[model samples]
Target: MPANLHAILSASSAERWLNCTAAPRYEEQFPETTSEYAEEGRLTHSICELKVLKKFTTAINQRTYTNRLNKLKKDTRYAEEMERTSDIYLEHLTEKAMGYDAPPLVNAEVKVDLTDYIPEGFGTCDCVMIGGDTLDITDYKHGKGVPVSAVNNPQMRLYALGALIKYEPFYGGMIKNVRTTIIQPRAMSEDDRITSETLSVAELKAWGESIKPIAQKAYSGFGEFKSGEHCRFCRGRAQCRARSETYTALEDFKDALLPTPENLAQVEQDGQDGIPTPAVLTNAEIGDLLTRGKSILAWYNDLENYALGAVLKGEDIPGWKAVAGRSNRTFTDQDAALASVIASGYDEALVYERKPKTLTALESLMGKKEFAEKIGAFIIKPPGKPTLAPASDKREPYNTATADFTGVTQEVLF
Candidate 1:
């Protein structure tokens, strides 16, 4: 309900909003806007605009609701909006905003559920012009960061999927003949900066299908990756097993470190300067060591409040956060314990732990030096897929009608 909040509304949601049809199997417990990609802004804006135009006696666009503008960069502002919906909302509000309003409920969160597996995939466009073949889907973004292009954005594509899914059922399979774009209202200080791009029905479908596998994999790995970045804002982050690793990484490094500024500086300098290997350590090895530590630290920092916290009244408060990490916190008392064991005449070999085999040894196991030049040393593995994608442009293709700005865009073909 507030502006600048990053609610996760996705394509599945867009489909449900426009159709005015909530799915029977669909049970959304959180606020309607809590979805990863939501479409509520459009609904709110549409209603506000309608009220302003219909009430001739109303001197002010008595928009009863307000929204908190988005704070993050690359929120829904882009070019195409100026070409279409900008005029519509502006005319409706007939107002100049001071800051963002949070109470005004709208269909701003629009997503195309390319994956039919999710029920919210079925969606209606934000605004529809009646008595014509033209269909325009308008979306609003409140964030303050750089406006990302709606073209090739998965969020927009998912919204597209929802549009097609909802519209095609009644209009028949041909869901084409249109333009799509992001309309950033504040960008130009006039209307929205619109990205004038067109998407074929076929292309939209293809893009939607392309992302289905990715979504499926995430759903599958939800358990394994539950604790890391996923846990940061996850609805179920508190009890996830994957998040447990985040805790482990954090705990391992939360040592009461004795800061050795000089020692650390020398080690880091040696690594960067590429000092030759001495009997003790080499610069190259130092760099590698630093990198490994960074990697481990990153994994450890993935844990949120549970692993990193600053308490006031023995309770955690929002905003004032803390950082913690995982590092090998060896028990110093171990030397004393070891000495007692030696006193008992235990073999030194019994005290030693087995070390993991070096990667070079694994390579040697896979290849023989006899024909090492000709044999493959090791099989390569690709890195994992990235987690996040950009926000979507919530626009559908429509012929640029220099038509009456006063004309309606939503038409009931039915």
Candidate 2:
């Protein structure tokens, strides 16, 4: 899924629906700037799942449960404000956070794959508590503030789809009364939010139909490339010509005009009450005009960080306090751990080296090693000066291939 222009710009659900349907192009586009910790949250989710599934199937607690309230608290390298929300999820999973129909769990594996058609897609959900036919799919949101509902969450719906497919053979009946839920760990905050929604059978079928063309197009050719907001996650973000031009066009026309809502009548005897004003403009000028009217904080870019630096000890000379930065501890250092191992009193060397450094090193690594994983350039199909790299090539990621590409279907992830 590298820089194939078609893959880069066309990955969004909206983009998929828009390209096939008669939906008119919006003058504006959204770019999904997914965060680093969001990526880490995904990784942690995978790790947690490995542990949970191992435990669920083997009926033994494999992963050592730690006193650390959250994962990052136990392992400090990944802690940033970006990870604070993930920590919240950890707390929720470990039963340190709050209320749950069942004890809070982390990375509780739930999957959904719309396999009814070709190029079928599947997503593993973050967490959930099984409650009969009502399977609550709680996707972790590392963003700050109150948890948002997973209601109508595409990922959750997809998870439900996967669950249905999985359970059909085992449960053998219609898999009636399946439901989903989303759990946000943090208490209500200005920035942290979680939302959930349930999907009707009609809705899921409709969604399947809606995404059919996108999957098909992704499989068939890189042609029909278009640009819009969702391209923020595009691996070719820095150099996508279509994305650049689309954003540039929107910015250029930012001051065009907007159709404003007009007030119908004047204020009555009420002193404070006033009549609403009606002004009209297009999407362009509306931004400027609306900026002057109210103090609506649509995007809270500032809530990106929360951790404050602790006092620096003996290291700093000026305007600094004498204290160590907030840090974490490990169970390996505990006398109790040593005593427990001694009590079991078996081979000390094997017990001591149970978790070798190499194993932990691999666990701590970032990203997949595949070269073909890089963000690729976006372009239309029937590639012109196309990079001739093999589809299975793992040397470079995305469309980062040095070979020049022309529009072609092979450029995308089928």
TM-score, each model? Answer: 0.36, 0.45
Candidate 2 on 1-414: residue-level lDDT in tens?
Answer: 122232221212434333422111222143445666566655555444544444334433445433222454455435443333444444444542134354423336654454553243555666654433344455665434324445545556666666666555755543344455554544343223444466554566577577666656555544444644333333333444554454445454433343233222233323335433335444445655455222112111111111111222233334535445598876856778876877886676766656534421332342223212332233223313434333333334445343343323355544
Query: What TM-score quantifies how close candidate 2 is to the native fold?
Result: 0.45
Model 2 lDDT, full chain set: 0.44
The global C-alpha lDDT for each of the candidates, from Candidate 1 onward, is: 0.41, 0.44
**Shift in Å, residue 374, candidate 1:** 78
lDDT of 1 by residue, 1-414 (tens): 123223223452322222212221122332232432223344334443443333322333434322221221134532333223435344332321212242221233233333373322333344322112323344445322445455545545565556566566766644454344455544522223554345777776676666555444433422123222222333333334444554455544423232245556776876755323334544544554554464345444544434353352355655655445478868779989888897899988898777866544543444334335553444322222323221232433333352322133322211
Q: Which portions of model 1 show Cα errors greater than 4 Å? A: 1-9, 12-124, 128-135, 146-148, 169-174, 187-193, 220-414
Candidate 1 TM-score versus the reference: 0.36
After superposing candidate 2 on the true structure, give the runs of residues whose Cα lies further than 4 Å from its correct spot: 1-39, 43-58, 62-107, 110-113, 117-120, 128-130, 143-151, 182-192, 250-255, 258-284, 288-414
